[model samples]
Target: MSGLIGKKIGMTSLYNADGQALACTVIEAGPCVVTHVKTQDTDGYQAVQLGYGEKKEKRTTKPLLGHFKKAGTTPKRKLVEFKTFERELSLGETLQAADVFVEGDFIDVVGTVKGRGFQGVVKRHGFGGVGGQTHGQHNRARHPGSIGACSFPSRVFKGIRMAGRMGGNRVKVQNLRVLKVLSEQNLIVVSGSVPGAKNSFLILDK
Candidate 1:
C-alpha cells in the first residue's frame, strides 16, 4: 500500500550497524482494516478506505456502525482513504507495518503538531523581542513592535506574522528513513522525530 494509519508511540535511541546511536520515533502502524473500496466505475476514482484504532460499539453512530458491519469488522475510531495500493484489497482485510514499509525505505509522515495557545511574536515568528533588558522595556521585551506602515498605507497588512495561536497544525515531515519494522508487534522505527503528541494518529506515506 502507499500509506497506512499509525500512532506515535514515542522517541527512542537505536544503534545502527556502524555502532552509532540514532534518535528514532516508534510508530504503531496498522493492523488497519479495509472498510471500503472505491473503483473507477463506481466512484470515478480508485481509493481504499482503511480504519484503525478500536472503538466500542456503543460509542459508534448508526451510520458508521452499519458501515463497519458491511466490512465485517468491529467499530474503528479513525478512518482514512488512500488512493494508491500495491494490490487489490477486499473489505475487512488487515494491513500491518510489514505490508507498507521496510528498513531503508524513505517515507513521509503527516500529523497534527502539539498546540501552543496564545503565543507572542518571539515564540511564534522568531522575532527577537522588541528591545534590550538594559533599557526600561519590561513588557516590551516580548512585544511585537512596528506592525504597520507609517501613514502611507495607513492600515495593517494581511498575513503579518504577529502571533495569536500557535502550533496544532497539520504538518508533513518528509523523507524519514525507515529504520526497523516489527511485523509481529505492528511497529516501525523511523529516523528523526515526527509531529504530534503521544498516541496521536499519523499518516505514514511512501
Candidate 2:
C-alpha cells in the first residue's frame, strides 16, 4: 500500500536502549514526487504513482520527460505505483521518508539481490559436495553427482536446483523493524540486512 522508492545506503550498527548493538540497513528514501494519480472511475483502480531520484534529461526517454513535465517535476530515476496512501495527495506533491514510516514500524523491503553471475551448485544451492578426499573422489568434490535416474525417468526433472545463473532476483524481506528515522536527511534505518547491493533501488512498503 503506502510505500516509497529508496536507494540502499549499505548497513550499519546502532546501539539500542538496552545497549545491544543492532545491525541495520540504511536507506535513502523519498523526497518522492507524485507523478500520476489513478482513479477508480477512470483507471479502474486506485493508486498513486511516485517518482524518486533524478536522471539526466538526455538519459530519460521523451515520453517519460513529457510525463514528468505534466507533473511539474524533473526526470526521476524510478517510478512505482502504490495502492494505498495515508491521505489523498495531489500530483507534483513531494513526500519524504518520515511521511510514510516511523521508528518501530514494521515494513517490507523489496529489492534485487546482488548478481553472482554463473555459479556452481556448491555455492549457489549449498550442496555439501562429496565428503572426504579418499576413495577415488579426486576433483569431484564440488560436483553435483547423479542428476538423473538410470532408466525410469531417464532425463533430469524440471525445476531442478542445478548450477546456473544465481542471484539478481527480486527478493522481498518482510517484517523488518524500523530502527530509526532521520526525516531531515531522508534516511531510514531498519533491522537486519536488505537485499541488493549498495546504491541499488528498493521499495519500502507498509
TM-score list, all predictions: 0.96, 0.97
TM-score of 1: 0.96
- In angstroms, give how far residue 69 of model 2 lies from its true place: 0.9
For each candidate in the order shown, give its overall lDDT on alpha carbons. 0.94, 0.94
Candidate 2 whole-model C-alpha lDDT, 0 to 1 = 0.94
lDDT of 1 by residue, 1-206 (tens): 48999999999999988999999999999999999999999999999999999999999999999999999999999999999898889988999899889899999999999999989898899999877877677678888899998888999999988989999999999999999999999999999999999999999889
Clash counts for all predictions:
0, 0
- Candidate maximizing TM-score: 2
CA deviation > 4 Å runs, candidate 1: none
lDDT tens readout by residue for model 2, 1-206: 89999999989999988999999999999889999999999999999999999899999999999999999999998999999898999999999999999999999999999999999999999999978789988889998888889988888899988999999999999999998999999999999999999999999999
Note the residue pairs that clash in candidate 2. none
In candidate 2, position 78 carries an lDDT of 90
User: Candidate 2 regions off by >4 Å?
Assistant: none
